[model samples]
Target chain A: MLAKRIIPCLDIKDGRTVKGINFVDLKDAGDPVELAKAYAERGADELVFLDITATHEKRKTLLELVEKVAKVLTIPFTVGGGINSCEDVAQILKAGADKIAINSSAVRCPELITELANRFGSQCVVLAVDACETQEGWEVYLNGGRIPTGIKLFDWLKEAERRGAGEILFTSMNHDGTKNGFANEALAEISEMLNIPLIASGGAGNMHHFADVFTKGKADAALAASVFHYKEIEIPELKNYLKSEDIPVRL
Target chain B: MEKQNIVIIDYEAGNVQSVKYALERLGVNAEISNCEKTIRQADKVIFPGVGEAAWAMKKLKETGLDQLIPQLKQPVLGICLGMQLMCAHSEEGNTKGLGLFPVNTLKFPAEDKVPHMGWNQIRQLKGKLFEGIETESYAYFVHSYYVPLNEYATAETHYIKSFSASLQKDNFYACQFHPEKSGDIGQAILNNFIKL
Candidate 1:
């Protein structure tokens, strides 16, 4: 059986490591290459580098950053943020990113998903969806959760899967930054709906939260930024905890 | 003594850099090339692939590497689709493979979830690639199709069914999983391959 993954997401801004809450007010974490090596040594199953403020210059800078980090990593790492076109993805992958995640670009042009999957294989194309639960219902958001779209969460998820997305990086806006717990109810529903792997991001506060996300939420992988970036939870020991809980995590 | 040369066949499958970096971290700098001369001179050759088999085979044929690979005297290692391409055939794209091993690659039943994308345990190991690797240790994987257990299989992993995790025949070795992305255990596998 495949083991569940524990991933640490690094929010990269201005070519340095940064962490943010609800996608705002960035805090410097450390050097990306340094943090990446630390995570890999500590048994992080994977790592994600999301360039928060991805300007044209910052994109090139992040590209270089990905290269340096890639040189030291022996684990699979994903690069995201401001990946608008196939060309951008190509450059990132060439710089040693095992996978590429697209957000706003995928919303603006769904065909980019198919294009990436076709050109690079579906295994490396991840669809990152930022969704918030509202009184009306759960809906998709764009531009780092600033704007809302007419597309509902389930509808967009189904469409993304149909368009050859290999995995779904579902971030619940309602649960993000609160550290209460993952949106287990929504994650369970989404996992049940899709056969592909679901990476539950946004609300990961503690080790037990990781356990809940896997056993209750049925997520194949759990990604968190603050918990790991701030040293609130150590990855190696966390994997031990998950193993004790029979969560089947990579140690 | 002449230094050992490591070559990663670049058939446009991409992600070859990760493989190169894995070796360089172990003090073995690998040269990525598709040129016949560079590849033919390798002490150990790493055939890495990540895309469609038909497209990969087409790229190999274009560079005349398909013809060159089988004739090499050095130890050749294949990863993921590179491992599948070493088989006699693959159901993906209805393509015929290099036939280095007489096995055939088949897709996981649609009823059973596919792409098998995660780390899974490897057992029943009996090859140099797994010398230092702990039994029951997991290796990272990402593929829908797999080569079933065969005479060439050196290790096995279970998903929808028991499949060949690693295969060995003569000087040729291949792994269905990505050792380059599997961290420490994977690094050990690559180091073992270099020693071979």
Candidate 2:
């Protein structure tokens, strides 16, 4: 059986982790490499480093961080944020990232998805879609959910799958940071529509939320940040909870 | 014990760096080479790949590795696409494989997810490759096609159906999962392969 994955997403800025991480054993919470190592050791199925760096030399720092993380971390990790072109992806992969997630760049030019899938194979290309529920229905958002694209969520997801996206990382902006729950209704629909794996992001506050995302939302994986960073929900304990709930988790 | 010469066959099929780093963590420095002589001379060779099958086959043929791999007497372990290519054929791109494993790789039926990705358990362990690893232990997997259970299978995993998680035939061993990226169980698998 394929176990439902538990992922901890970290925000990176200028080569260091940006958000406040509350791991007491961590010597340097800002260090992405150390945080990643700790997460892997503590039973994180995978890690996602979303580089929020906005400097001209951001790429260099990100590449270096990826190299360092790849050297020590044994589990798979994905690097996202500001990845615009194939060249950018090549450098990240060369730096040893198992996968690369592209959002705005993919929306800017849908052809980038096909080109990336062609060059690097679909397994490594993750299409992260930021969506919000509006009166017009689920509409896609860009620039970190500040701008609306006028594209319906389902329509765009169908197009992305056709364009060779290996997996879909759908983050419901309406539910993001709310600690309420995942957009299970929308997620179940998307999971049914696509053949690739769907990773449910946003609105994971507790261990039960993870269970809901996997069972109700039908997500292949669940990704959360603050809940994991602040020790609000420990991964091993969460996995144990999931196991008790009859959810297949990698323990 | 004398230092062992290990080579990771690199044909630009996939991320060989992860494999190299995994070995480095185990204190085994492996050389990444596509050279026939380098691969042939190593005490152990790691064939790691992730990509389309026909294209990978073309690259292997271009580098003359298609001919050199089967002839090597030293232990050779293939990962993911490397394992798929070791089979008789693959439905992907209608690729004919190295014929080392007497089986064909077929795409997962449309009823299930095309790419059977994520952590899955492997059971029915048989060979030294899984030594000290418990049955039903999980390993990370990412692939569209799979080698059905066959005589050479040393381990099996179930997704949509039962498939070869690991296969062994004489000196050659292969795994459909990325043991290099499978965390502790993965590292242990690699360590076992190194010891072999």
Q: After superposition, how far is residue A24 of candidate 1 from its true place, in Å?
A: 1.4
**Quality class of the docking in candidate 2, CAPRI style:** high
A77-151: candidate 1 lDDT, tens digit per residue = 999999999899999999999999998899999999999999999999999999999988999999999999978
Candidate 2: where are CA atoms >4 Å away? Answer: A20-29
Predicted structure with the largest TM-score when compared to the true one:
1
Query: What TM-score fits each model?
Result: 0.98, 0.97
DockQ of each: 0.82, 0.91
**Residue-by-residue lDDT tens digits, candidate 2, A121-155:** 99999999999998989999987787899999999
**What TM-score does each prediction get for chain A alone?**
0.98, 0.95
iRMSD values, candidates in order: 1.0, 0.6
Task: Write down the lDDT of every candidate, Cα atoms only.
Answer: 0.91, 0.91
